[model samples]
Target: MGILERLSRLIRANLNDLIRRAEDPEKIIEQALEDMRAALREARMEVAEAMAELRKLEREQQSYAEQAAAWERKAAEALKAEREDLAREALKRKQQAQALAEGFAQQVAQQQALVNQLTTQLKALESKIQESEARKALLIARKKGVEAAETVRRFESKVDAHSAVEAFDEMERRIEAMEDKHKALAELDRNDIEKELERLDANRQVEEDLNRLKRELGLA
Candidate 1:
């Protein structure tokens, strides 16, 4: 599975159920916390890699755009010297450069989206890990309290054990609720129409640039 998928599964795992089934709650909680930390580290690496890719794409797009502008200037210079043939050739090069720049621009946008998504997931995972760590401490302490009470008195041990189980259940419910909230927010943030509009705007800008070049060369 993908890294995000794995992290999501870890975040959504039913810790209360795991504690109930495990022979040793403390060990189970500790192990679960460790697993979450490991996942968080992996997620950080993934986010970093994604951001790096985005930056590379942006740089490529900028380089191609600069090349396109330079070619346009060369075309204008050729036209000024009345070399129509050379001007046309330069314009062809300009078009080619513009096409490459546009392609790279699209890739940069997509990469940026991926980076944003990974960053959001990384933040959510970090929050989950922090919460889990706090819960783990509480869970282990409760387990120890129950064990100590058992040695002091059986009746007191039963009460403490029951309380610990109740606390675990409550924590599990809170976690599930938090996960649901994050899912809802993510869903709401997705807007296909906005992406479509952005693409249209990019195309419009390209057309405007071409028109401006035509006018500059007195070909409009």
Candidate 2:
């Protein structure tokens, strides 16, 4: 309702509680800070207006007081001149002016109180805004850090390290099996070449022995 009441509500708000209850804490903090700043602006304006009103009241009280003093002096002069009716009229005027002055003085006191209250509320709201701004930054940063950590955790959870290692081991085993098969094929080819060479050597020795036998028979 009142500006001071609104400021008090804003100052009393629990930021941490709001953040905890919010689904998006960063957004909540930002909104809360914005609200505080808005309230602070309004509060400053209210305090300024209150102070202006207080000043106006003080000026009116002073003016009325001066009028009362002037009327009193006129009453004294009329009395010295022995004009009893004029003196009575001046005294009445002085009473009226004094009453007005006193009324303005009372108003000034009330306005001064209002101004003081508004000023205090304004200062409190400013301090709250400052604190909320600082906390907003810190809270946003912390929320980001928490989100980053959660992302990393989700990624880690999705990727199984044991499964990755097992896949690598399986691939290595397949490659080693291929290499063993190739080495066995090479060994078999070498054995076939050795057998062919031995067979050629045996055939050549048999031909030479037969020729020697034929030469011995040619002597007949």
Candidate 3:
């Protein structure tokens, strides 16, 4: 693209948007600002060169004008001396000098116009550079804010996950406690059944022994 178009794009760029899209926003923003500064410096140099050309043209014009005026005075002196031929020659020289002066004046005017245009462009570029510099801090801050928000989100997610884990652990502990209680009740029930069995077996043995004693005493 043309220089002006490039400059305009650079000047109009949205730094915040750039920062948001950049992978490394600080580095990118700094580089962009530096590029703008470099462009502005180059534009300033161009403006200086244009102004120098304009000054040279102006001096040339002035010199030619002075020569023309001196020739005109010489032509008048010739006329005052009543020398027609010399007067005519002097007039001819004066005409040539006047033509040269007019041409130089035109050139100077064109150079002046170029200088003015370059100066305006240079000023605009400088202003753009300044504006970019001013916004850099704000753009960096915005990037930092985004990063902070992301960090907070991650922290909250971790906290939520930890809470879920703790809840799950509590549920497991409660289930284990209930299982232990059920196991204790089952053990108590088994012990009661075993005691009843033992009592019945002992009574059966005692009856048998009583029968044996009766038989021996002849009371079958």
lDDT of 2 by residue, 1-220 (tens): 6675765577447555675676477767676777777777887777788888888988888998999899889989998999989989998998998999999999999988887777777777778778878787788888899999999998888675668877998999999999999999999999999999999999999999988898899942
lDDT of 1 by residue, 1-220 (tens): 5566886677447565576676476766676777788888998898899999888988888998999999899989999999989989998998998999999999999998888888888888788878988788778888889898777798766777797888999999999999999998777666666788899999999999999999999999
Question: Which pairs clash (backbone N, Cα, C closer than 3 Å) in model 3?
Answer: none
Model 1 stretches with alpha carbons more than 4 Å out: 1-3, 10-23, 154-220
Pairs of colliding residues, candidate 1: none
Ranking by lDDT: 1, 2, 3
For every model shown, what is its TM-score relative to the native structure? 0.63, 0.69, 0.66
State each model's CA lDDT, in order: 0.84, 0.83, 0.82
Task: List the candidate numbers ranked by TM-score, top first.
Answer: 2, 3, 1
Q: Can you write out model 3's per-residue Cα lDDT over 1-220, one digit (the tens) per residue?
A: 4345666576446554566676487887787887678777777777788788888888888887888888888888988999878888888888888888899899988888887777777777778778988899999999899999999999988987797888999999999999999999999999999999999999999999999999999998
Best by TM-score: 2
Superposed model 3: Cα runs more than 4 Å off = 1-3, 6-23, 162-220
